[model samples]
Target chain A: MSSLVESTVQETSHAPAASVQSASLPRLGMAAPAFEAVTTHGKIRLSDFHGTWLVLFSHPADFTPVCTTEFLAFAAIAPELRKRNVELLGLSIDSTSSHIAWVRNIKEKFGIDIPFPIIADSNKEVATLYGMLMPGESKTETSRCVFVIDPVGIVRAMIYYPLTTGRNTDEILRLLDALQTTDKHKVATPANWKPGDKVIVPPPATMEDVEARLNAGYECTDWYFCKKSV
Target chain B: MACISSQGELSESARKMLAAMDASATPEDVASRTELPLFRVRAGLREMAEAGLVELNEEAYSPTQLGRSLLTP
Candidate 1:
């Protein structure tokens, strides 16, 4: 397959939140806000990620059991993320010392070092900016939230979970793949779309498209469900 | 409702809420406008402990002078 077709294939199989939006969120496909902060790796600018896809995430705290599990999952997949030319950045309201200590503990106990920078947001600036600090969960900590930004800094996707539940790593990677595929191929992934499945062709938004779709030799249960090659 | 007779600066979220606050807006309205969870909106209001930032009458949430400052442009 051509590189374009390969990227489309990658997108259909990737994460859950890619291209999805919650009803209350700011519209997707728009520029994400710029932020700079002190992370585990040191001070970094949002612009530093100018040429790569970014998975910017927030967790409530360090050392908590639920957060630890989620962190490890992401850490284990760090190589895969890097392979895809995507960078992962974590955030929390804890101080830098706390983040460092927690990472060390995870390494010693779990035998893994998180490869990405964990933002030590001492003053909750990043949390508040990302709308991660939900007071219902904890006033001083961020909730579990994820943002997927494209190479140009447009926020293509975001997902938030209640404090009681952890997020899925596979779902996120799947989303990143899906989004990049859509951008590259101008196609859409079907619900529960996985790799090798037929993609949803953008249905006719205008009258002419309806006829074009009909003539496209696609499987049409309905005009809206026209399935075509990716 | 907490009435704002004075003025002060607003936080980003609060400023967003103030623009949407009409006489009928409640905590839900503020939450929707700021894209904050309901409890977060409550906490943000409470965090605004500046004397008039949040006025609670019965169960409704309204801004005070300092709170309005955050919302009013």
Candidate 2:
């Protein structure tokens, strides 16, 4: 699946940007753009995270109040993500040294060590690739963006926040759990769903399925809308 | 404590390394025992140490009391 998407990207990379629709923010279900970057922990590539889920997020800049709180929130949930085989990678248009210093300062001030690797995108190469930079907002800073990529490198979900707002860490974790649960059980999550809650059963595809589902022993609001304990 | 709840949060590789570790075992010993690559063993050890489940002393690695409790039940 990813190979097909990569070939498509390769074919388009040579074209002039003005000639084609500017490759805007990657859409959901597309293969995540590949990149090699210098991070606070070490040099890493997208493929380095193969076979694990990745939450790739971008912040505006370092040492800011909102970004600091978001980082702390992300750090607080690092262990929970680790339990689910998800790795967090942060990005900003900052240098590696600046990133190191900011992270050190955060550790010292907050007593919370950020366990994730933060990409130093001073040149904006990674930011450009991910379409994290919103020129209308601020040319020099990345917008608050989150891309959740699955184990196979396909982007599954994304969210963007304006510069003035901070992200909700709980929503991010809930989304991750919902995606994983859907993938594992082939069920859809209802509104305000959380782990251990009943899940929505896939709607019936045919009349035969509808008939079978009517007596399938599920908690059925209707044949088309059923809930199950998955 | 967070560490106690985090006992169930170790990655598969880290858990394997923890299971393979004994008193005075090195990262190399863990790699050999678990048949994991050396780099993976090292990474697992680092994560385990950070989680407060393992300790390193005099070039050897061993499970901390917290880590032992994780294995108990």
Q: On a 0 to 100 scale, what is the lDDT of residue A23 in model 1?
A: 20
Q: What is the CAPRI rating of model 1's predicted complex? A: incorrect
- Model 2, residue A131: displacement in angstroms? 1.1
DockQ of model 1, rounded to 2 decimals: 0.01
Our tally of clashes for model 2 stands at 0
* DockQ (CA atoms), all models: 0.01, 0.04
Error of 1 at A132 (Å): 0.8
Runs in model 2 deviating more than 4 A are A1-24, B1-73
Pairs of colliding residues, candidate 2? none
Judged by DockQ cut-offs, is candidate 2 incorrect, acceptable, medium or high?
incorrect
Lowest lDDT 10-mer window, candidate 2 chain B?
Answer: B1-10
